[model samples]
Target: MIQRIQSVFLALGAITSFGLFGTDAAETEVPVAGSEVFADAQYDVYDSLILTGGVLAAGLLLLIAIFLFTNRKLQVVLCNVALMITLAYAVYGGVLWYTDSAAAQAQVDFGALLPVLTMLFAALAARYVRKDEKLVRSADRLR
Candidate 1:
């Protein structure tokens, strides 16, 4: 379980997903009326229920996949699902940032890359799970 490389990758994916809560996704500057000043607003995963729940779900799925080491097929499936969800949430976050009226000078933050990292980890885990499955099959054939 924990000894497997796939499990480590899955754990990393989960950690990255959960890390979203600790960082800001975007920072926007709202211009003041007739002034050369702007107020800064930071957006994070907690700002939207969808973003919060999506990250939570993706993290949980990766964690669950890590424990499903005995069932490589299921673990791969879970990783794929988590990757898809992470991609979706990332795109949604980008869309939100693009559409924000006060985001005239929006700056993307580190949290915005968490989803991409999670997706990469999930994909790597799935690939390794498949490799392990193939290795088991080859070993069984040799017996």
Candidate 2:
């Protein structure tokens, strides 16, 4: 089952989520009161309780879905859930950028796109899962 195409995609999705956990989510640059130089403040997702929980849950869900080879329907549902979690993470990141920009300098780093990649992988995995389910059904009708 681990050799399945969907499993590979799920693995990739999990890996990307782990990257989200390790990398810098965003950065802000603000000048000191009397200095011409600006200092960068980096935000890591793991530092926030909510973000950390959401990201870890997405990755774990992928892993759980991978083992549900016997239940294609459940696997598809879990993958979709994981996809939503990643999408929510990206939306929250945008909200932070929008809200933070008004008060001070805020720059969204490229790492913010990691959740997008995770979503793509999850979507691909779910597609393959659905294909497999359909194939199984068609074959059952023949026998």
Candidate 3:
């Protein structure tokens, strides 16, 4: 059961979540007061404790879910919870970018997409876990 497809998906999700620490979610150009130069500011998950903690928690949840393959129901629930956490952090990052008045222009980076990928992987894993549960229930009924 540990070798199932859902476990693979959960692992991928965890990897992507952990990958956030090394990538910049967004880049902004801030004009310096009394100067013609614009300063480049990059924001990543590590920039805020809330973001950093949320990402780390999400990654840990995915990793824990992988080992819970024997409990398909709980694994699915964990995947969904992790998905929610990832979404929250993604939105939080977007809000930070949007609320920064000093930012003249913002560019989305690969780090911004990692949370989306993690969510996708989590959803896929949950779907497969549900499928496995259904198959098991049906097989039991056949006995």
What is each predicted model's overall lDDT from 0 to 1?
0.85, 0.79, 0.85
Residue-wise C-alpha lDDT for candidate 2, range 20-121, written one tens digit per residue: 866776665643242211123666675356678779999999988989999999999999999998888767755654555332454566677788889999
Residue 19, model 2: lDDT of 84
* RMSD (CA, angstroms), candidate 1: 3.7
Ranking by TM-score: 1, 3, 2
Which structure is stronger by TM-score: 1 or 2?
1
RMSD per candidate (Å) reads 3.7, 4.1, 3.4
Q: What is the lDDT of residue 117 in candidate 1?
A: 92
Stronger candidate by lDDT (2 vs 3)? 3
Candidate 3 per-residue C-alpha lDDT over 53-85 given as tens digits, one digit per residue, 9 for 90 to 100 = 999999999999999888899999999999999
- Residue 107 shift from truth in candidate 3, angstroms: 2.2
Shift of residue 114 alpha carbon in model 3, Å: 0.5
TM-score of 1: 0.89
Sort all candidates by lDDT, best to worst.
3, 1, 2
Best by TM-score: 1
Pairs in clash, predicted candidate 2: none
Task: Name model 2 segments beyond 4 Å from true.
Answer: 29-40, 101-107
Q: How does residue 89 of candidate 3 score in lDDT?
A: 84
